[model samples]
Target: MVAGLLGAVGGGWLVTRMRLFPALLLLGLCQALVNLGYIWLVHSGPNVGVMAAVVSAEYFFSGLGSTAFVVLVTALCNVRYSATQFALLSALAAVGRVFLGPIAAWLVPQVGWSEFFVITALSALPGLLLVVALRGAIDRAERARVH
Candidate 1:
């Protein structure tokens, strides 16, 4: 909880000051890499300190990534349809959260924890690719808002 709180607040502040792409890319990358920490904990065996640290780091990065994602979504919204678009986009974003659980459950047993985490980390690539593709659009939108 403390990690989450710190990440959310700190990330929000930091991201607000950053250029859009850098902030989003950094947060997304960090979030992806953080999942690998769990792989270490699993192999290292049960140590309460490591478990707490890994969980905290996960929460921290998740909070940061969530903030970055919201910023991207909000930045891309049209003012005329801001509410509806934001709602729709937000719901679309939750699709993975809604479906990935059962998928992960099935996957974990098949690949084991270490490989599962590697796959999880790699899954961030598609989103990062989208961010790259949308960079121009996001810049245009921000420009529209400012001017």
Candidate 2:
């Protein structure tokens, strides 16, 4: 876990410095694979049902937290206001921690491990779709600048 976090930080820095889309894409793919691996590991252990429930609750709230952060940050940003935008983004990140533990505890008994991770993995599809849809706009923006 520590290594993964450190690697994420390093990957983010590298992406920023290199301004490389493929690197970011690879990092995102790696994160998904890692998450899937974690789910597989949990399911393979004893108490599969309990583990599934716990992981499900953990990731559900995590998704909510991530969504809230993204929305709040996007709303606060002025396109021209970088500093204040990012600061507000940082503050909103704390909202996730408040319910993370309790949610996990509450969810474990209700859902099994395999289904929980599978659902979480499926939730990522919407974001992927959004990126796909935006590809055309991104290409247009790039093309416009070339002229």
Clashing pairs in 1: none
- Candidate 2: Cα lDDT at 90: 77
User: Among these predicted structures, which one has the highest TM-score?
Assistant: 1
Query: What's each prediction's clash count?
Result: 0, 1
lDDT of 2: 0.50
Report the Cα lDDT for residue 19, model 1.
74
TM-score of each: 0.93, 0.50
- Candidate 2 per-residue lDDT, tens place, 1-147, comes to 443344445554554454233432344344344455556567566776665655554454344333333433443455678678778767765665586568756666678665565655665566555545655554454344334
Deviation from truth (RMSD, Å), model 1: 1.3
Once fitted onto the true fold, the runs of candidate 2 whose alpha carbons sit more than 4 angstroms away are 1-5, 13-20, 44-80, 89-108, 136-147
Which tens-of-lDDT digit does each residue in 20-139 have in candidate 1?
A: 788888999999999999999989898999999999999999889888788778878988999999999999999998899899999999999999999999999999998889888877
User: What are the runs in model 1 whose C-alpha is more than 4 Å off?
Assistant: none
Task: List pairs with backbone clashes in candidate 2.
Answer: 52-113
